[model samples]
Target: MKIHNSRLISALFAIAFGAMQTVSAAAETVRSLDDLAFLEGHWRGGEDFVFEETWNGAEGGVMTGMARGVSSGELKVLEYIVVSAEEDAVVMRFKHFRRDFSTWEDGGPIILMLTDAKENDVTFSADPPSETVKSIRYFKTGENTLQADIVLVEDGEEGGFTLVFDRAD
Candidate 1:
């Protein structure tokens, strides 16, 4: 009976290990910015508040983009963003600006490192790891539609928001 029980335990352990391997394999690390070429173009969203983004195609291992938001016919926010391949990971760095062109960050750009990618979906984590904003994900839902999900982690609490974008070009 003791031997039988030990064999059953070993079999269960093997099965659990195999399942873990499968899960890990599904989250492949991002290799290049080429896979993200679909993101290039002008995209717009929001109704009461207008949001727009324009992304340049990848070139020289980098892709540059800009975003703007307007409310009540007044420019509210602006952002400059870039994606670049650095070693084994793709890094997304962005900086925010006010309508008056004043910078939001004092020191450096906010950095987010690619963590996992599959098909048209990609995930990025805060570069220095933040307690407030943890990760962000972009998903291509249709030929001309993109969705962004931002994950927030603060005070041991988790929260997030999603933004849907439609191709303007």
Candidate 2:
């Protein structure tokens, strides 16, 4: 009886561990910027403010882009962004600037390394980690619409906004 019980317990543990490993493996698929080529174009939209972003097509393992936000006919914020392939991971970096071209990040650009990805959705996290902002995710909803979600990881808080861009070419 003791031998039977021990065998049963070990079998259950093995099954449970295997299930966990399967889930983890599915959640860590690597993605490339070429999979996100649909994002290449001039996109503009905002609810209370006007926002615009222009992205060049992926080439040579890198994509370059710029974003701007305006309110009441006044420039509010600007960002220079880049996405590049680094070894086996995709990396995103952004630097914020004011209307006068003054940088917002005194230390340097914010870096986000790819964590998970699928057909139209990809997630990235700050490489060295941050208290205020931790992750950013982009999901394509339609042929020309994209949604961006920014995660504030300190307390697990999240906030996001959507942008729709028409093909400018």
Best by TM-score: 1
Global lDDT scores for all candidate models: 0.86, 0.80
List model 2 lDDT by residue over 17-88, tens digit each.
Answer: 999999888646657887667677888877678888888988898999899998999999999999998777
- Model 1 RMSD in Å is 6.4
For each candidate in turn, give its C-alpha RMSD to the true structure in angstroms.
Answer: 6.4, 5.8
RMSD of 2: 5.8
lDDT string for model 1 (1-169, tens) is 9999999999999999999988787545436897677778999999988889899999998999999989999988899999999876888998889977889778788788877777888888996676557888888999889998988876878898887899999
True-structure lDDT of candidate 1 = 0.86
Candidate 2 wrong stretches, greater than 4 Å: 1-28, 153-169
* Candidate 1 displacement at residue 104 in angstroms: 1.3
Pairs with backbone N, CA or C atoms under 3 Å apart (clashes), candidate 1: none
